[model samples]
Target: MTVIPSLNVPLLGVAVTPLNRAELLAHIRDAVQEGRQMLVAGHNLHSVYLWYSLPEFRDFYDRAGAVVVDGMPLLALLRIGQRARLRTEHRIGSTDWLDGLADLEGIQRVTLLGGTPAASTAVLRHLRSLGGDVAWQGIPGDPWRAEDVDEVAEEIRAHDPQVLLIGMGMPLQERIADQLAARLDVPVIATVGGALDQLGGTQSLAPRRLGTMGLEWAWRLATDPRRLAGRYLLEPMKLAALLMWRA
Candidate 1:
């Protein structure tokens, strides 16, 4: 698999990988050529909540290849919670990986799952603009549960991409990636929440200034108040309780 060793930084009882962004990307590129399938995961607050509070997510991540800090707070939390000396130069999330995949060479094929047909098609068009040689496929459907995974896996196998991008959002995407690890012939599977939507022009990201200040969550909460209130507020409070209980 990936020869690059992952720093084992466990937060709220869930294992997280803190790796240099450049190195990990290179390793993923190399692993694809070597035919060693790698399952990469990136964690946001919601992902952390699920990993710590749900046995199902905890188990799946334990079986993953590498997990990066997807949210800004997650990076700080990982360093503060465990292996204090750990220093990951970049907060390498799935969105960053998606950008890299489109920009980087040698990766021949990719499959995108999630986003509406319009959004997914837009994402494919963007990827094509970045690189003409990268073939793309969009698995246009949401498999909300484990039982639905079999048919989804079938669709993925039919295209058989070197990199599989799952964008169905948090827990669902996490579960889907786990189910496909053994079922599909893809070399890499990644979970990117709404990234395809952002790329497809369906959604917009916060300003870089806001992101650098770690106010990205606030921006999201403001823009999509209805959808994010529970995630940005309730889940974090629940997570605090779990952390205190653990302590």
Candidate 2:
């Protein structure tokens, strides 16, 4: 196994790896070709904070196939801290990566779960445009309940999807994917956040320029200040405090 460099956050045992976007895609492609089941997860600062403080969250990441570097700020800090030997030019988001996969013919039948109706619809439209054969479903509300599980599982099994894409946002999506993997025989599952919104036109993505600069979070905050401002600003501070306390 390849060992990424260690991150020294207080109470956090998370590590940064040398892997970049190309490496990530290559691995996923290989897994698909080999017919192996895989799970891909993306983590931002909020997720990092939660993982450090929550045993269950940490366990989820520990079991994931690839826990990616989703936030530019997090990647920058990792590079500045020299915690990982990652390539400075390597940066990619989950949405773009998934879009790329939509073009590949060997990806197998795909199922999309989670996200609001509009978001899921948009993602389905985009994938169809790319000529992929995808099995799509959108949960109208929260999918954490046991009833939701049975219903979603039945749909997934009925479709017999080889790959599943879930977009319920952090921890929740990850937990759902984990449970689905245990309960079902799907080979690959990916947990993506807000990707459906961007695809569906419900949420606008940060401009390419801002994204390149790692200020996409600011754009998101600007677009949905009421929804994001408090969480983004306060979560990091809380995570930092938790880390310090652990130390």
Candidate 3:
């Protein structure tokens, strides 16, 4: 097993590994070499809320092989509360690293589950353009549900890919990735929320500069306030109260 050091955050009742993108990919490469099935998941502010609010969500995270720190806020809290040595570069958004998976030495076949047919096509095209021996395939999973787990697993198993990337948002993706990791022999099963859409150009990624400065949430809020205002504004307050109460 590739043992990445993790720090416990009592505030969120979760553990986060401070890994930059290269380190994460190296870990994934090691997992592939060891022939181990690993679920690569991440934690952002929204996931922190779900981690506390939903039992299944918490369970899924508890079982993840790697739970990377994905948001600046969560990274800050981890440093402040845990008194760890995490740096700004430790916050790894999935969009920044998805492309690198194609270059993994032992990975030849990758299957993606999630996004629209068009979006999946776009992602596949981009991955193919990377000029690797990796065979890429995408299955449309826009309306994935709990009942579809078995069928989805079957479809992924049929592809016989070495890597599986689940992009269905949130709890759903985590749910499916957990089940698939248990059912399939894929070396790496990644729960990448919205990464497919962003890679496919269906969703606009926030400017890289904003992300580096920890203001991507502001950009997302500005772009889609109706969908994200509560997530960016109200949820932090709730998370703060939950942390204080737990503290």
Candidate 4:
């Protein structure tokens, strides 16, 4: 199995792997070819909140094979840690690379879980257009609950995909990813929050320039203020207190 280089900082109390887009894709390809298991995940500020507040969520990151920096603010914090060695390029949002999975040379089958039925349909349509040689399947994970794992695992076992992308959103997706990873032989199970929704055009992605400037949160707030305002505004303060308590 590939032992991905990981670092855990006291500031965040979470583990992260510093892999840029190309390196991340290469790692996924290698894991599949080598028949190795990897639970690919990422952390943003909201996930950081969940990490401190939820034990099961924290456990998933502690054991994840790869946790890349998904939030630019988190990347900035990691860069200061000297030991993390995170660079500007290491900040990878799923929107930046989810489409690239279609181009991976060794990957032949991919499964997508989560999003509404319409969103999953759109993702399948998009990916199929990119990789004619690959097979894509989507299992709508709407209304997902902890109780649904067994049925979902059975569905996954039938598909036998080389990669599985779960996007039911934080904590829940991470929880399901952890359980499914343990029960299935799939090589890579990536917990990719709402990347599928954005990719499927059901959700808007911030412009690339804005994301590069570390103002993607601002764009998200502009788009869905009611839902994201508290997350963007108040959570950071809560996170600060959590970090201080931990420190």
Name the candidate that leads on TM-score: 4
| Candidate 3 global Cα RMSD | 1.8
Can you give the TM-score per candidate against the true fold? 0.88, 0.86, 0.93, 0.94
Candidate achieving the largest lDDT:
4
Ranked by TM-score from best down, the candidates are 4, 3, 1, 2
lDDT of 3 by residue, 168-232 (tens): 88888887777777787888888998899898888878988898789999988888899899998
In candidate 2, stretches whose alpha carbon ends up further than 4 angstroms from where it belongs are 1-12, 16-18, 83-89, 132-145
lDDT score for candidate 3 against the true structure: 0.84
lDDT of 1: 0.75
Put down candidate 2 lDDT per residue, 59-116, tens digits, no spaces: 8776667777777766777667765665544556666677766655466567888666
* Runs of candidate 1 exceeding 4 Å displacement: 1-4, 8-11, 78-89, 142-148
Task: Summarize candidate 4's per-residue lDDT along 155-176 as a digit string, tens digits.
Answer: 9899899999999888788878
- Model 1 / residue 165 / CA error / Å: 0.6
| 1 against 3, candidate with superior lDDT | 3
Overall local distance difference test of candidate 4: 0.85
The residue pairs in collision within model 3 are none
Sliding window of 10 residues with minimal summed lDDT for model 3? 1-10
User: RMSDs, each prediction?
Assistant: 2.6, 3.0, 1.8, 1.7
For candidate 4, report its TM-score. 0.94
Clashing pairs in 2: 37-187
